[model samples]
Target: MRARLPDIAPAGSPATAPRTFLRAALAIAVLLAACSGEPDPATTPARDPDASAEGQAGPIISIRSDPETSAVPAWRAPDVPVDAGNLAQRKQEAAAALEADELFGEADDAIPLYLALREHAPADADVATGLERALGAVLQHGDAALAAIDDDRAALRRAQEIAAVAREVAPEREAVVEYLARVERADAAQQANRSGERALNARKIVVAGGKGAVAHFREALRLRPGDARAMQGLAAAESALIRQAELAANQDDYAAAEDWLAKAAKVRPDMDTAADARERIARQRASRVGNLRDLGLAALTREDLDAARRHLATLLRIAPAGDPAAVELRRQIELASHYGLFRPGQAFTEALDRGGRGPEMVVIPHGAFRMGAADDEADARDSERPSRNIRFDRGLAVSRNEITVGEFRRFVTATGYEARATRRGHSTVYDERSGSLVRRSGVDWRSDYAGKPAGDQLPVVHVSAQDAAAYAEWLSEQTGHEYRLPSEAEFEYMLRAGSQSRFPWGDGAPPAGAGNFTGALDESPGGRHWRNAFKGYGDDAWGPARVGSYSANAYRLHDLAGNVSEWVADCWHDSYRRAPVDGQAWINPGCADKVVRGGSWASSPEQTRSAWRLGSDRDTTNARVGFRVVRQI
Candidate 1:
């Protein structure tokens, strides 16, 4: 019961959507002081992370996206102060240390000794002046170390050690606090530069969450805006995006090219380079379009409509608005399925809108042909009298074979439509036990001639005319094209396929291995052979074979004359009194019966004639009947 064809491709969803993120922690923090009068350099409102010079304090990014986590060390954990005893002796010792130029190394150094004297004498200007000179020397060493961070990482570590000593001797000095923060920022900037270079070398150009080369390079700039290496890395990232844009433009995907260029603008923020790329794309677009048009037209000439359609899709994406060349190419491709471009007997298929494709079809040429049997034709019925000259001005395509179980299963599954036999729970099937046709229970479109489960390649039977029309309608919707049961006249003409003989072969008897018809040598599954049939022909088939099992007709159609009788669009009439002049369906609204054409394996010699016809109830379902469709160009 769950017999759906596995032709459709499964749908998919995006794995990850790109998004924006606000950097946190050590990613460039800037704090400003009160917007009042101009503040002096000591109270210069130090930013949280950056420093213009190693001697000054500012705010900037760090090694990580987080603001608080970085390579910059913390303010030296609270150091012990110099011992403040023996005030006069301490001052004299401090003076001697300063004169000897032993700044602040040991306990008896100039700055430490001065700090001990200051604690005893609150208004000691001499101690304060000596401490300032010692502080100046510390700053000179720290500033020089900060500048050397890019060349020598050990220098940055040395700068931090010196700043810690200055803070310990001159605890309340603003210059010491600023100098320490500047050194930390320079260290963070160096780490960011190194990280960016690693990512760039591995080709991690752009990541969604600020982990790629572009993000690292930008962070380095935020920490130290003048870093030459970081600046160069960022430029390289922008250039990569531009190269991608050019590649997409070459493939005729202008929308994707523009998308790449937009990303480049965000990375580099330059207008002129982006504009130049756009101009180059525009100049190349005309030539690309010309090449596509030429290739598409050539494909049309060769009847490679699929390749032609592909080129047309590319033209739609890259061509300028309302371009005449694009419009003309579209028209030419649309008209390719005609007499001028398409040859008779050429096979093709149409792509469905959702997935897969319609049944294989053979193009039929446009010409006038005799529709019905003549008066002198032997064994011709009254219904075939007064044969008229029917003309087909428009080229048409017919299914190469009868609709198979696999093809019909797709229609029933897509629409959840039940066939008439399934609704009735019974259909006429061949009873092998009695060697005769009998109504069987639970037999529907899924069963074969003997009421067994059918193979997918076997022609679908036990379906009413209404069910066949429903399948055709579903095909039309899936393919975005018109498809319906062929007209009775058209069916007969294709069955003959340039043959004027009684049968599709010639006047007398069928050729060897002609078709699946009633033959004297044919045997049924029950070991019974045909009682009345061709003298010595045996097609080796007791029931319907897989579609396209035998040789094709003159028009490259399979199983037309002998396989199964097929439903057509026309309603049954007694004679050709008021038949349609054009090869269109003849219908009386709410008619009781539908026209059936072609012969079956159980047919006698007369029944196997190309001019054979049958009129069955519209809702009748049987194993001996199937259908084929016609597609309009």
Candidate 2:
């Protein structure tokens, strides 16, 4: 069920470029957060154990697209007080402890002490008060920082929606900025662990980190000023328009406020926050005498007396001058005297109710990339002949890495899923030195490789399409969500992540860290390197390497192009000419040939192309063929 290919790094492989390393490092940074600070036991939030991976909180992500619970009023929790003397004493004690290698308790303990000081300190206090205040802010509202991330993620989804609507319109920057900034921010936030001030630095990197995320967004508009993502980002920055509207309203600049709010509403009408802003604009407009008359007339025409009454009450707030319309304004005011102002915050109260985890899935953005073989790419086969352009939809969640052996085992134990190759079948285990294949004895999911002990983080191999499907179904049932083999399109979309290059990484073979390829193994000695290519006895170890044993793709998806061939949901189609344009698995009622993707560890370079497509019977199984599951959005 679980298998590991050997790691054989080649000697003197080129060192990875620093910029690329930083970029890759930023993308995977989230997973590293847990290991940074000591887990705090003093202030623990009640976390749901059955929470989905996307929604789980462990110093990183806290909210999902839909929160399972309603939002609690930002309640003020109980606080303990401390005097200036005690505070100073504690700081000195903490400094001494840090000198003695006891920082574990500092970040965790310092938070509460600082929070108490903030609650009781003078408003104008400086120096020590300021320092403790900042530290407390980081600790006490760490959740807010976490929630800001949630908002940033929400803004991304909103941007995608607008992009869909404006597909035909000129570019919008607000949406683009939010979308790019989010990916860069989350990626940096996730990786800020290597350095001591990473969390603080994460905020700074959002100011431009990954591969010029901010720069590309800006330049796209420069190149084709109407590009969507770029315009979206600009729109996001100008979001201050809404705040300006509120300021106008406070200054009784009703007309200007209305104009500004109307623009805000039109810009992103579907967003929840925008709706709230619109309600405020309505209330502000109602307070004007002339506006009240207009509202009353409009309400009367619609026969909504309650709305007319509310408008009139607001009209009387500032008495109108002695003009001809004064009598009418008073009449409207009297009629609307009992009316109440629209409540802005009510809509979001249950908003959290509708919330659980936002998407509970990561969004792998869309783009075009080559998906086939390359020169010097070994293991050429008929199915992998030509590379082609593969376009993916804007947002999809590819597994952050290959489904680890440990994760796979959890599925097997829970569903009792069986591997078909392990069931009354045989597979050829290639011998690198002899250049010969030996039919390995005995097979079945549970019985094959019984004596071999390998890591649970390795890929699960020897699985048929049916086996993969069954496992997916089992996972779905257990999780109360749909889980199944990714459709051929979905698999390609994920493998490509956001790039259109030949491999999951880019136009050419990825650098050694990008994957566990033959060249990579030839570069490293002593330590294990994923034997990506077959050069002879020493080139490839001829086995599945650990999942994520090598480098990850642009989206941090591991083993996407190699390590093992994965089963996809669709039946075999020689060409994508008639493939589904909407990114679904192409299923035919009578089709018996299943699609398999990503070359296996045994496969040479040529087989790993993005467009390489292979067909196998539904019942066929082999050590090289495995699977990764996908959740429909």
Which candidate tops lDDT? 1
lDDT of 2 by residue, 1-633 (tens): 111111112222322211101111111122222233212323322222111112212332111122211222222223444576676665554344323322122232333333444555636254245434333332222222223322233222222222322221212445434433443353333222222122222211123242222233344444433433334433442243454455566655555655665555554445665568767666554445566666664674455777877665665544334432344534434433222221101111101112222112333434455554554454545454454556544334445555555656666665566566556556544444444445565554432222144467666665667877886676566656566777776777667655555656655555655554444445232344444453332323346676767765545567787777888999887766556656668899888899988776656565666666788898876556777776543
Instruction: TM-score each candidate.
Output: 0.48, 0.39
In TM-score terms, candidate 1 sits at: 0.48
Please state the error at residue 597 of candidate 2 in Å.
1.1
Candidate 1 Cα misplacement greater than 4 A, ranges = 1-341
Error (Å) of candidate 2 at residue 529 is 13
Q: Please provide, for model 1 over 1-633, each residue's C-alpha lDDT reduced to its tens digit, 9 standing for 90 to 100.
A: 111111111122111100111122122211111121212334432221111112222221222232223343333322224444566677777777776655555567666666666675657898888778767776776676566544433455556666767677665778888887786666666567667655544445576678777788788778777765567667665655565566667656777777777766777775466677778877778888888877787787798889988998888778988875676567667666655655555689988776888899998755667777777888999988668878877778999999999999988887899999999899999988888899999999999988999999999999999999999998888888899999998998899886777888887767776778888888887799988898988889998888888888877899898778899999999887789988788999999899989988888888888887889999999889999999887
Give the 10-residue window scoring lowest on summed lDDT in candidate 2: 343-352
lDDT scores for all predictions?
Answer: 0.73, 0.47
Estimate candidate 1's RMSD in Å.
21.7
